[model samples]
Target chain A: MTRNTRLLMSMIFWAFIIYLFLPLIMMVMMGFKDSEFIGFPIRSWTFKWYQVAINDMEVLGIFAYSMTIAISTTILSLIIGTWAAMALGPTKFRGKFILFALACLPAVIPGIISAISLRIYAQSLDITPGMWAIILGHTVHNVPFVTLVGIARLNSQPESHIDAALDLGADNVIAFMRITLPFLVPSLIGAGIFCMLTSFDDFVRSFFLGGYEPTLPVYIFSQLRTGMSPEINAISAIILLITAALGLSAERLMRRNKKKV
Target chain B: MQTNDSTVRLQNISKKFGSVVAVEDFDIFIEPGQFVTLLGPSGCGKSTTLRILGGFIEPTEGEVFLGDDKVTKIPPNRRNVNMVFQDYALFPHMTVSENIAFGLEMKGQNKAQIKKRIDELLEFMQLDGFGDRKPDELSGGQRQRVALARALAPDPKVLLLDEPLGALDAKLRKQVQIELKTIQQQTGKTFVFVTHDQEEALTMSDRILVMNEGRLEQDGSPKDLYYHPETTFVAGFIGETNMLSCSVKKIDDDYVVLDWQGNELRGVCRSGTAKEGQDVSAAIRPESISCSAKKPGNKGVMKAKIIHRVFKGSFTSLSLEVDGVKDCILNATLAGALAEQLGDEEVWISLDPDYLSVLLR
Candidate 1:
């Protein structure tokens, strides 16, 4: 490559990175600004917004609600997704490709479309659109992610281990518990974190399906309509920190599991 | 421990997958405390037969018996048989000790007894002091030993090994073969080992069942299969041999005269029903033929030119081209000293009547 091409490539790469992170960096910076209004030129440093954001009872309650939904979604998705993965992971049967495609439909379709369809379905069924409805929607959306992870892990695992377990006087359930489940731990941890993050950060789905009680993302969207404040920036920074921590821990767990294998 | 009553019998078993017949009319009765090997080439149904005996797969027809009990419909976990898979299949998540103790734990053995049994097996398999390590931390041979130890912990009635040393290097494989034989003898348990390697089978098994094309070709002691093969397949598969297509010219009381490429060769009539003017195949082991530079006063000696001589350490293999035999190449393994002196020279090859194996085509 010539000097011009190398320079152009590096410039484009940095430009892409800056484009992705510029808003996040600005939000974090404004969280420390003393001014009530979020503006560019000059801001005195203050931690008052952080203090106010942490102390707001309504924001804390909404955060708790999001956590509850995310936790429930993670558990439900993990259970159903693991069963689906085990059924589809290792064997060939008729219509397997179609079944797999249908399983992954929620992930492939746009989130807003699924959210609107789910709301309509819930209304037709005469179900109240509230926390339970949102939880159901999130579970359906995240099952594919968990299922894909489980399938990948199962594909790498040898079937001989289960056979050996069975040949050693362990029945099917014992073999599964002793060999298959332990082998799937790393993928389970990674997929659980992924499901939790997906639920916590989801906006459009919650906006459509959530009833009187608002989730953290919906609450933040409402707050933005009122006005862009430093308090919102403070909360976003905290969420980013939590997400980074979770991502790092997931990476560490996977690396450690790989070394063990 | 119950070696005396652990006779396994596969009664006319046949298994088919889809339309492909994996095993057909496979029948074998393993005596108590015998070390039997299922030996064949790849895709020859040896592994399938072993799996069927282990209750991993149900045979499409026929019954399986352990001693007097029929176990045709039994699941693998319910049968008193264990297998060492070709890949070892050691549990990666568990430590070596944990893996070996798994079966005993499932049997509801007390903790102390399980611990004691594991220690004994670890020592017996020569894997002492490595119990705390995971399988990934061990070498290939070590992992195999661990797999064997795990299978032996519960003391199953019969242990099946499916090419367990297939993953090891050549040197390690030879060492494991000896160790495995010694272990089988010491345990006095019925062991049914499967391998595609003919030499491994000959070295380790008390009796070998050779299969080809989903059918049992021959089953006997290794020496019986090698020297007195019942079919042409067994004669060629067990060892290096020269096969001469011939027709019986005359059958004497104890000897048969074979007409081969316009040359008359006399061989001992081992086949009881040899008839005159019948086509047959004459098999001669390479080691049995003696090569000499000077013509010997032997009745069955033939003059041949040395086409190629491969200098193996213990013996030199000479490929001979005879004047009368134009269609077949005769191979003979001579002593290294004699082979060195007879380079590219015309020599007389003598086939003793006792070493010749005659098979009906």
Candidate 2:
């Protein structure tokens, strides 16, 4: 309300912003430091760590492995979560709230708890700690975000569009495919990227159910156990760049979709 | 037996949501090329009945017939009916041309046929050169016409419109109502329109079915419903009314004498149950009440004080208080300028006996 309070608020907000970005800035700066150890007085700067991160075959393989798992998790979660969302969207059934709660319960539980339960469940089903197991765990965690975003988008859709499609002689499947799915594409893409990015960087579940070959996050954790190096910082900075790009595109698309709708 | 020449037949339709009845025992047979309106207030089962006809809603108990075939169990896609939703319901993803082509494509029409029909409809709805535009690109009225074009593209047996003009401004709504009626007649398609607006129903529909509380109150022509409503709900819901609660003093062959606040007023016996000493309401329209400064010589006349005068452009509505009655306010709508004529505080009121129909419950 007053000038002093406004000044204080501005000071606090800038401090919080700096507090959040300072570590990331430091980590990215440390990647360019020309020392074996990552104390960041960069007496010399070189692109050699970035070159190593790009050229190392093992790191390349793990990055690709993480990408493949994220893609699979995104696909599976989109299908299952969109189904859950549609189920929760238009129906007036008695158990609809219960169904929605169950669909979103995984997102509320601790990631460690979800990982341990998934590991135990996989073991009970005679499944091995492999890529399939890791993908399954990631999908379970990612689906709730898809479902939440999908339901919200679906709610914004007019119920009459589907009805008009039906009145125009489209069957249920055709109506959904033509009218509802196209309407949901923006949210689906946004939610899909969200799912993929979360799955890619996830460590707890991947650590529990990962195969002999490590995903990038699991491999990074392994590298941390061995030692701290600028190589790891370079890999993380690259991953951050990719995530930023994807997140920005997703946000832009959702904003554009909002304007269109 | 299925009736001949009837385009739609809703047989003993009843819909219940859990324990609440939405439409009860509603039966109507619509002839071909007729513009019928299910007219009522909101939540009064008009939309529910229309949805039943379009097969969007399944009545808990009913059999629907389109022409000679029964379509009660059929879905909306299989039924030979199309609906223009209240919100226009145009697909936001599709262009106008694509939206119009959707129904035709579903009918398995060839590409050429679909294109030809789309052009024809765009022209018919006066939306030429606007086919490629998306719904958001168009104005409210243009979007409504586009919705009409899309619904008409399929050439269904019956076209259902659920308050499609409700979203437009008042002037646009009147323009669209006339355009829609003209389009229906030109195409000779059966139109089952639904609206809570009585004026719209009167202006467009050949037949209006007035519903109240899940029951059909009255079904007749616009003039018939306006002049000769069978129930009080129809009278009050259709237009402004001066419901003079009176008792039947005497009933003759052609006229019934109702004693209204100690005044004997003659009115047409609408429902034929005007017995002696029975309570009834004289449903009098304000336009039917003639007002003059000089006392009228009519037998059932009222000398009233002018309470309030609201001057409309075409006519003036004056609220009058009857002498010797504490709260008996009678409204009179007189044509032309009456400000110069009625300079006195006291006014004479005379009811047109023909328009003053006695409604008996």
lDDT of 2 at A94: 93
For A1-261, candidate 2 gives per-residue lDDT tens digits of 999999999999999999999999999999998989989468999889999889999899888899899999999999999998988996689988888899889999999999999999999998999899999999999999999988888888988998999999999999999999999999999999998999998999999998799988888888889997899999999989989999999989888887777
lDDT of 1 by residue, A1-261 (tens): 999999999999999999999998988999999897998864489999999999999899999999999999999999999999998899899999999999999998999899999999988888788888898899999999888888888888888998999998898888988899999989899889988999999998888999999999999999899997899999999999999999889878867765655
How many backbone clashes can be found in candidate 1?
0
Residue B73, candidate 1: alpha-carbon lDDT: 96
True contacts kept of each: 0.84, 0.95
Q: Which ten residues in a row have the lowest lDDT in candidate 2 chain A?
A: A252-261
Please give, for residues B110-177, the per-residue lDDT of candidate 2 as tens digits: 99999999999888888999989999999999999999888988888889999999999999988888
lDDT of 1 at A184: 94
- TM-scores for the candidates: 0.96, 0.94
- Cα misplacement distance, residue A106 of candidate 1 (Å): 1.4
